[model samples]
Target: MNLRRRLAWLPLAAFLAGFLPATPSLAAEPGSENMLAHRAAYRLKLDSVRDNASIEQAEGIMLFEVIDACDAWASRQRFTLLVGDRDGNIVETTSDYATLEAKDGSSLRFSLTQMTGGAVTSRVAGEASVTPQGGRIRYQEPAATEDELPPGTILPMIHTIRSLAAARAGQRIFVAPLFDGTSADGAQDTTTIISGGWLAPQPNANFPLLSTLSSARMRIAFFERNTTGQGGGAATPDYEVSLRYYENGVADELKMDFGEFVVDGRLGELQTIPSPC
Candidate 1:
């Protein structure tokens, strides 16, 4: 049912002017030239569990890192989820997911490996290219599968840029196709609802990490694309995520809702990495 893939969602770091204009160091994207690089850790805890949710108790640690690779943005998310089943047994699952996207937003490469009870459960590797008409992905793990993305679609990193850009431009809502390699379902249509507004510097202990940055609240909903409009407006979303996105692309205060249950992740630690142009 691609359960593990569904668990692989996102959570970013970096400056206010980083998106204002493209500089040699700050090339206007997360992984561009001299963009913000940082490592962040979060503590995940169960929020609300529905009657159908098999998860009884969920607690884990999530570590995320973003590196600027000159022409590409390199990102990795290492998560360990401890799940308590109804049978009074606990299973520890770990997922290591990484991706590299070109700064020009033309291509993306992704790898995901999931281990349950210290055993590998799934591995998915793929690459996708964006074009004027749409995009295509070539998967290499589990089984080779090819999928198509519609026109006006955007990848993960580019989605971050565009969302932040929209917030800066006073735009409230945006709909786009996103391919994060988290699922075999290829590209999912996403609608981003943006709120909040730019604010002056804050008294954050993280200093440049959060104090000097502008921020906005964003809720992104994912849905299966409907080529046939027969479903009409009653279609429900597959999943939904809401977080605070920084001007520099870093996100925290994550709440992931899977309909039956909810998981909350709070930032525990954050460190900015020096960027080299």
Candidate 2:
């Protein structure tokens, strides 16, 4: 299954907002007023993805909103995802609602809502049983079969930002991308990276205001190669992934332009999740 298809379990609209510009940093400087009041929203535009076999193009729209924030303590977020094709016809759309609160040391309570299709169907709802080691997020729910409930929903994009904030600059951290289990393909289509670079401080802005603060250019791509089974395997590919955080790192605006993919011989998938206007 493709990355976007696997991500379909959760609301696709929310993740697209990660492409927007970065927000001002809420961390206060020495002797400076505590201007790090936490709260932010982001709007983003969905890009196009080409299907190699069908030669079809898919377009989408995404919105992300940070309902609550207390820096490293806790946060609440919501997202909406919509997808279409070259002719501007609606393909599929849904929404995902989530909340993250710090539990014990290095642990958190993760919860989510599953919305499917354009009609906003309520598939299932659940929380994580136990936090993964090293602050990693490890939660799963069964497939949305007629007999069983939908898999444990997750917000991979928000978890990425949370992982970033939990660590100090120059420190390396491993973030487990959101996985619904049902979409795990034989090719091991997962990507990982070590990102820790300079970020400009965000300017002073009135709380709950929408604005572009800072921008950073970074690299994101797949690492390990698949070699065990059939099909092309074992050659890692590289690409450029740029991300912009808004509202003082409470939200993100991301842009990932994969020049090409090796195994599939097709372009990478790009989508946007924006906040409600």
Residue 225's lDDT within candidate 2 is 29
Off by over 4 Å in 2: 1-39, 51-76, 103-111, 114-116, 119-124, 129-168, 171-196, 202-242, 246-248, 256-277
Tens digits of per-residue lDDT, candidate 2, 59-120, equal 34333333222222233344343434445554453445433322122223333454545454
Candidate 1, 63-100: lDDT as tens digits: 98887766667778888878786788888888888887
Winner by TM-score? 1
lDDT of 2 at 66: 33
Candidate 1, TM-score vs. the true structure? 0.85
What overall lDDT, based on C-alpha atoms, would model 2 receive against the true structure?
0.33
